[model samples]
Target: MEKYIDIIKNSYSGYWRYLKHEIISVNHWDNYFYGLIIISVLVWVLEIIFPWRKDQAIFRKDFWLDTFYMFFNFFLLNLIILIALSNTVAAFFNDILAKIGLSISSFQLFDVDDLPKVLGLFVFFIVSDFVQWNTHRLLHRVPFLWNFHKVHHSVKEMGFAAHLRYHWMEPVVYKSLLYIPIAIIGGFDAQDVAIVHFFNITIGHLNHANLGWDYGILKYVFNNPKMHIWHHAKALPKHVRYGVNFGLTLSIWDYIFKTDYIPHSGKDITLGFEGDENFPKQFLAQELYPLNLNDKKK
Candidate 1:
């Protein structure tokens, strides 16, 4: 009977350990979802306190769009790529990126002896910022791409959903272009990549939100909701006004580059591409458009 007891105990121990590991892994992936839930709740609370827009639909139309985008970026993109591409075409590109000396693998560029989570986090954000900040600015300067990029600017209601009403091109550019440096260099771990996405996904929405949240120096330090809303502004000259708020998480580079703008009156601003007020805002139109600033229809 003692031997029988040991066998049962062993079976229970094996089953319990398997369950524990499963829980940890699930929490790791699902933590991103939890972060969104938590942030969204906080944002709702903030909307009541410091409202930014006058449009009623701001509340109605934008929440789901933002949620969809949050879902797409955190899970869909990661899952599809990891399953279909990351180890195949993706790995090839990563190696090529390493050869070119752009970004490094988390396993290689980082010192194995000792590494700081803070520094890794900082590098991840900065590198991604450098890529995105420039790409976003280009969409404004380049006439051809503005057609698709303008879909993001077409939003007038300014709500959480407004945050997600981007042209598919935006995500294409964001994931494909921005992640290039990260993928090629191979310098990040799964956790490092996860944190960067968390901040990018969260902060990007917050900056574009209709609800007001006082980030203050954080506004100056990093791109805030106000700063981003200004980027989408449709007003004249179509310059990158609040473009100074380029850094996704840190504005040191923006300040260094002298591109940061913080408006004085503290009012909600208009956003749209300068020339094409008639451009379509629908998904299909945005996918096919670029409002070529170079050649007018005449």
Candidate 2:
């Protein structure tokens, strides 16, 4: 009990310290706080200058809502709830593993640290993106998970900020699945590879933005706005039932696996699911949406 309490306390304290550093300190290139602001503003400016959906308002419907989700999911939620909770859970998991005498400390399949810096970063990026791709598919394929994922798909007007407008449970699902595979690639420094993280965020922002761009020849390699808009289309293709275009960062996975589907331009396509009109519009309600056991009990 004391150990758990210590873990919670440490998590809260650590989160505050990190948050303070991100706020008061200005590291320009390596700072996520500033990176988020800079990237968001840049993309938003692009949207204003060249919006594919010309009729959509500057402050589009649910624009503020999505912005709130961006900040909430990225920063506040960690401080308020998840940081401590995750630490406690992780501690418990480690204890269980210890009791079983199964050590994950040496789980690395190959040490990326031994390779050249660029090659190591490349390998780490590909493997991590692949993990996320599979996790994104699971969010669509699993019914219960889809309930939480609905918050993201509820977007009627796609924008840059809409990239982060997802249920908090999503990171939990994503990071939980991402842990082991990353552990397998020994000597992974998140700070050292912050560029890759930011790059993915940029791609995610573009994918959700109201822009029509498929990197021509590179369309098969990278996910672009044109290909991703269909992922949110109200109607799914007849051939693909679960969902399509499940790529998070790279389109390569979807193309290789045949999950990629962009039958039309998708610029004016209706976004959201069949019963989205009834989905919660507010942040708090959406956070609690998937776990609404009251509806299930009925």
Candidate 3:
């Protein structure tokens, strides 16, 4: 029908507009690319100076695969998914809320726009981080979700580039879940979102890097490489929690949830999923591996 055809055309046009205005215009390409380079170089240097596993070479197994994952995630996959899905997802939640005679705006914590810039940034960071922490926990705890998450944990060696290595479905799920709560709290403008992403990128890289600093008391506050390394440990004792330390930027959530675990020395800790030594090493294989639901039984 002409009506359906017009609707399709209008939908495509709206999506393209959203991509241009919300994603492309707001994405500070210069800051993002340059910041990644600087942090990566810095982490690389630190890794060389203080290697976690002396036997491990700089170009260990699956190094290039993780590099591919990093580029694929940053330059292509995640960008397209976020641009395409964000608006529709928000609208879906808004519609559901409206049906119940409620709306996201009614749940607003405060006028986020009215707050000072610094304060607004802080509030956004805390709320977003909390959302991220729980989403991450769910990915590990939920059986079906762990299929996608396993691609990340399959990393044999952790490095700065490892930060961006994730299943493509992850961002879609994470951002969709995050959008409703964020919209309710008075959605963040592009600038606030950009700043939070910058911090996230920086901290994420450091958390997954090979460096060994634990930050003493500060480890209780912000997540560090040492703390996160344990998250990737190949095996934990039966008494020890399997999916411990599920924080993103801050370790406070793990502590509160009693999931935090850090050994006195990480040099002996093994990484990767147990009984997954035969896990596919190629990017394409790993992407498809999750879909083979039969593997989950094993």
Winner on TM-score (1 vs 2): 2
Clashing pairs in 3: none
What is the Cα-based TM-score of model 3?
0.86
Q: State the local distance difference test value for candidate 2.
A: 0.88
User: How do all the candidates rank in terms of TM-score, highest first?
Assistant: 2, 3, 1
lDDT of 3 by residue, 1-298 (tens): 4544454555567655644564445346435545566777787788888887777788766778887888778756634555545555566667789999998888877867888888988888998899999999889878788888989999878888898899998988888778767776676787567778878887888888777877898999899998998898988766654588899999999999888988567665778987678778788888898888677777
Please give, for residues 1-298, the per-residue lDDT of candidate 1 as tens digits: 4544454555455544544564455556535556666776676656656676655443555356555655654445444332233334445565677888853454354442254777767766677778877777676666556555566666765665455565555656566675556654445576666777767666766776665554776665666776666556556333554243555555556677877665653355655655555765344455456544433341
Worst 10-residue stretch by lDDT in candidate 3? 22-31
Among the numbered candidates, top lDDT falls to 2
Query: In every candidate, how many clashes are there?
Result: 25, 0, 0
User: Roughly what TM-score does model 1 have, to 2 decimal places?
Assistant: 0.69
Give TM per candidate.
Answer: 0.69, 0.95, 0.86
User: Can you tell me which runs of candidate 1 are displaced by over 4 Å?
Assistant: 1-26, 54-114, 183-185, 236-244, 290-298
Q: Which regions of candidate 3 fall more than 4 Å away from where they truly are? A: 1-30
Determine the C-alpha RMSD for candidate 2 after optimal superposition of all C-alphas.
1.6
